[model samples]
Target: MNADRTKYLNRRALMGAAAASLGLAAVPALAQDNSTEMDAPSTGPVHNNTSSFRMLDWRPYFSDTRNGAILVDTTSRALHFWSEDQSIYKLYPTSVPLTEDLTRRGRTEVVQKVVGPTWRPTPAMKERNPEWPDFVPAGPENPLGTHALYLSWTYYRIHGTHDTRKIGRRSSNGCVGLYNEHIAVLFGLTKVGTQVLLV
Candidate 1:
């Protein structure tokens, strides 16, 4: 099969598994991320931005989830934000890179919530791109976008991206990338100790 077809098939399998594990009534059809390296990155800071991108209404899938919990569906490249009662939730498109051992499946907690987060590329990132700085001050140029939720798992985060188009694509170095506007909403709803489940 061709690459595109292979990707679709793989995502379908993964999504199926996640829905089953979570007891989701159904998994909505998701859009494929077509972002490429050739696309130009955004410049300068983006503040108070609102999203026009598609997001899932997570209420149906969140009934069994913990209040104020976060559940990431890697296959769908979506993040579910549960409300205080799991009766309501907002979902956002995200970027989950298809790299080796990049999936951080299992239960974890939010270790930190940062606004305008400064990014320090990991050794792996530096090794991949030596030109990257040891630190990227939070700005439009920074990949961390507007807000960030640091997970207990080292080097994992659910954060925003400077490039709005990158959302819904598998384009991160393991971190989950949300739209700046979407991240702002998630940041407000989440706390330091909120549960996070990645599937």
Candidate 2:
């Protein structure tokens, strides 16, 4: 009877180890798929629990892929970019605005691209947070992370964030946020005239 018990325990231990290894392997896959981990910019409660990381065609959104096209789906919490010739298609999980009041949808273009972009609180942001510093130079401490693509709209940008927790969630003040590394890749792919649509 003691030998039988030892055999059962050994089997259980092996099974448990297998399950643990499988679970560990899934962690990276979840991040890669842009699953429920997507967060948008804001301070409000997270009403949206999951992101819809679907690949969409540019035809439905843009009339033409002039100078490349970018589509930001606030509902899905995803950003899709198509290269000018449609040779490269990239999808990235993004952090959107915390609230609809802070969200802006519609057409815009990348007016500037900055590496190590500086950050300054908008008038509205300053009014809301009186204690926030007037300016933050380009660095790790800056909210704009390592790269930024300034849009046509004032005080709005699509940029990188050092805060990994912000990715795959709704955590931005107004601008869309991406992981620092992901934004670096996007920064290289996109140019100043790239067309952008937020919906």
Candidate 3:
């Protein structure tokens, strides 16, 4: 088979396995690092990322939903949020760390919220990629997308990405990434001091 077909078959197998392992009523994962061919065929209804997206309860991950609560499950590559009043809940696909060494688990909080946020490669990022630009102003080329939720941990964020393909995969250098639209919705739903937990 051609390489394209081979890749699709591989992903199809992976998604099937993900469904079994997650015991999904049916669901999916977060995304790949670079732009990629759409995983679900476009000729019919799209169901590529639904197999592992089952809903979850905040009680298991939070003491209270004060100022809202955000949960990032790196394993499943999903992000869950609950409003402070417990009236709103959202689950969005996310791109997690590229490796275990880049992952940061445990509690944090939204310390800042920025729209049209500028981008800056972390010191570590610059070290690894000396050729990368030192800074990028807010715009289409900015990797941070249109919004960002700065976490309490330095250099860590739950932000948007212009590249939609990164939404459901282990693509991020360190931060969690969402579709620009999803992050826009999340940015509106969240606030500074919103409690966040990553696992």
Please give the ranking of all candidate structures by TM-score, highest first, separated by commas.
2, 3, 1
lDDT-superior candidate, 1 or 3: 3
Which of 2 and 3 is the better model by lDDT? Answer: 2
Q: Which is superior by TM-score, 1 or 3?
A: 3
For 98-131, candidate 3 gives per-residue lDDT tens digits of: 6788788999999999999888777777666777
lDDT for each candidate structure: 0.69, 0.79, 0.76
Question: Which digits, one per residue and each the tens of the lDDT, describe model 2 over residues 98-171?
Answer: 88888899999999998988777877777777777788888777888888899998888999888777777777
TM-scores of the candidates in the order shown: 0.68, 0.78, 0.75
| TM-score of predicted structure 1 | 0.68
| 2 versus 3: better TM-score goes to | 2
Which lDDT tens digits does candidate 1 get at residues 19-136? 7786552534432221111112322222232223334555544445554778788777777776767555576777776554656687888888899888887776666666766777
